[model samples]
Target: MQIRLQKIIADSGLCSRRKAEELIESGKVKLNGKVVTRLGTKAEETDKIEVNGVLVTQPSKKITIALFKPEGYITSKSDPHHSQTIMDLLPKELSYLKPAGRLDKDSEGLLILSSDGELIQRLTHPSAGHTKTYMVRVKGFPKPQNLAPLSSGKLKLDGYLLNPMEFHILSVKDGKTWIRLRLTEGRNRQIRKVLDSLGYPVIYLKRTEIGKLQLGNMKKGEYKELSEKDISLCFKT
Candidate 1:
């Protein structure tokens, strides 16, 4: 069977179809010892395909793992700060897995780990508009007017304006407050910065859901392989 070169690259988990097309246009992709920049070029299973001089072959079964990351673990592959990484908690066989989206070192909860680069790109892309739900415990209760800025898109942090986000109050205690926030964008310490600017600093934050997948009862420091249904739902409309 033959398939478009971009599809082959995407199916191999090298990158998304759009990114594969960009790579093709950049003349980084080769077929049969020749640089092939034609977007519509097709390749068979036996065809010798290479990207950036590395042999490209169809990837094996895609693996998706849902991990409950604990606090104090970095979400990177290697950190010069000498901090422990999320990979340190995984089994030896999962060393190749990369985090789909990042959770700050002080925050914890559901982190999707996968070896499928295309799936990672799809899930993390802002255009995909996948909603990430977070349970935030703040230092103080904020007035309704304080949350107005979040929806108004006027909340600017570090010279970058934040996107409109949905905020829902979950509970309130003596001085502490619990809130559920949903956002389609992932910026560095975005939720925390927003709350801090509103005079209600975030004390603890944990991601509870992504798209239709919920963290459910997964314990801290534990992980589970995603089912076929989970994979389908991730990219489903």
Candidate 2:
């Protein structure tokens, strides 16, 4: 069956479809020994494909894992400026897996990494509507009224309007506030910015759940390969 070249690259788990398209446009993708830079080029699965000089083929076994990412570790495969990355916490054999979504270095907890590009697309796509649950601590105690902007879902920061989210106070202690939030959007530094706008800067943040998948008993820096059932949990509302 003929399919778009970028789709083949994505299905092979080398990267996302959007990234694959960029690779193709940049003349980094070759089909059957010929460099093809056209965006809509089609090819059969049997056609040889090379991405950046490496052969692209679907893995015999798709792999996914749930990692309890710790603070201070970058969520990428590598970074020249950073000394630590989430990949350092995994075995070399699992290096092929890419993080489906991001958890900034300052934040910690459940993160999903997968060798299945389709799964990655499903988990990270904004339209998926997957909710991420976080436990947050902020400076100063916040009364219910202070959080009206968040509950109203009208909070805007960095020129982007945030989606509706579930927010509630867990406790107030030692001049700090602890809260739980469930968000459907994954804007960068969103929680921190939102709280900061309300005069409650975040002191700590940890994501404990993605959709129905929970961090459970996993300790920081630990990870477990996900089973089919466990993967299904990630899509559950």
- For 122-215, candidate 2 gives per-residue lDDT tens digits of 8988888888899999999888888878878677888887887788999988999899999988888899988898999999999999889999
Off by over 4 Å in 2: 1-7, 14-28, 35-48, 52-57
Measured by lDDT, the strongest candidate is 2
Candidate 1, lDDT over the whole model: 0.86
Displacement of residue 97 (Cα, Å) in model 2 is 0.7
Clashes of each: 0, 0
Clashing pairs in 1: none
TM-score of each: 0.84, 0.86
